[model samples]
Target: MKTLLMGTAVLAVTASTAFAAGHSVVRLGTEGAYPPYNYLDDAGEVAGFERELGDELCARAEMTCEWVTNDWDSIIPNLVSGNYDAIIAGMSITDEREEVVDFTQNYTPPSPSAYVAMSEDADIAGGVIAAQTGTIQAAHVAESGATLLEYPTPDETIAAVMSGEADAVMADKDFLIPLVEENSGMVFVGDDVPLGGGIGMAFRESDPEMREAFDSAIQTMKDDGTLNEMIVKWLGEDSPRF
Candidate 1:
């Protein structure tokens, strides 16, 4: 997941010293690009499912939180560098990622990836494909017969398809479905590609206590049916339940 320049970038909690000291306020980081997960509204404030869920999680944990937005490419590295206390981005739990950062238990279960193309007949297998860099979809495209075009942001991946740079884009279905429904030119093509584990909050390995706090809060949401209600409210009534 960390594809950027990696040097002596030790996981220091300097950026979140207050949180490390068990302060009441913790800074939460996110990409603010993926829709229905984390994104900035017209007011430039964080708003989405993860935002609502994260706020509730913090409230349940009896802590105050502030939102920090970072690029998808550097989201993890910034977290490892202690740019924030935890990553509330829609990050998947993968072994490769686990090697660099510890993850709270998944809040959302594994979701399927899908290909969005200009037409239903587009060549998804042998044509060029676009995906955000450092993502599971990018790795999948790298291995597939189709040529892979990596973008720093999720919007660029979609733009690549719209501008004829790529035949299709591969990403989480939840992120693509809305775009497909809104655009007459774009439509879901090919079969679904199951990629990555569920979405989870990421924290420094040295901050297990913070991770546990959020983890327990998430479990409480699940036990009390609040999580599913939020999911259905933001995602859809048919969204997966706990």
Candidate 2:
């Protein structure tokens, strides 16, 4: 009877351990350069809409969370290799990406994408716009017959525009509006274009539970005032949301 009781206790302990392992902490990755989405503030702390939303999701799911900053181009590859448990970098959910990793329900709806010229003299609507290679915006630029100066990240493309190296940059309207506002010479030209769909949290294809938790948290935030508050904070009053 004593041996049997010890055996049962061991099995219970093992079960508990397995359960704990199954619900391990989730690590979220982002490119710390895209403002209003994920970026380092003046104090060098990661703070933005995506960062705040990610924290909220982790809290709602009752999961320990850690944020990892990496280059934009490496985010998806790292996620595939298990370097990070998820990606929250304003990543658009498109069919091309679905071929590799699965995405949670879109938290941010699709907003129009646009181009901003750094110089008033620069004809953005007729000239080339710099875009990050392998992004949906790049594909749109390609379709427009405008020369696409491909870069590794949005920061690089923005830098090129600021330096007068590129005539303009094609990106989400929210990102460009703030940038153009801060730079007097910069202005968004041309009508906004629909790139694809909304931005969603991405996770490994096998992690259905984690994906579900994030999706539920995103929906909860959207239903409550949290998402609206964030949009107002980052995008200001006249911001568009679709």
Top candidate by TM-score: 1
- Candidate 2 stretches greater than 4 Å from native: 1-21, 119-126
RMSD to the true structure for each prediction, in A, is: 3.4, 8.3
lDDT of 1 by residue, 1-242 (tens): 36332322443544345556768888899989999898999999999999999999999999999999999889887887767889988898999999989999999888889999997898988999999999899999999989999999999999999999999999988889789889999999988887788889998887778888999999999999889889888877655568
Per-residue alpha-carbon lDDT of candidate 2 for residues 1-242, written as tens digits (9 for 90 to 100):
89865664564344334434775577789888888898988887788998888888999988878888988877887776666678999899999999988999887778889888855566665577799887898888887777788999888899888888788889988888877878898887767888777899987776666788789998888888788788778777766543
> Against the correct fold, how does model 2 do in TM-score?
0.86
Give the worst 10-residue stretch by lDDT in candidate 2: 11-20
List lDDT for all candidates, in order: 0.87, 0.80
Native-structure RMSD, model 1: 3.4
Q: Against the true structure, what is each candidate's TM-score? A: 0.92, 0.86
Best by lDDT: 1
CA lDDT, candidate 2, residue 92: 95
Task: Looking at model 1, report the run of 10 residues with the lowest lDDT sum.
Answer: 3-12
Candidate 1 — which pairs collide?
none
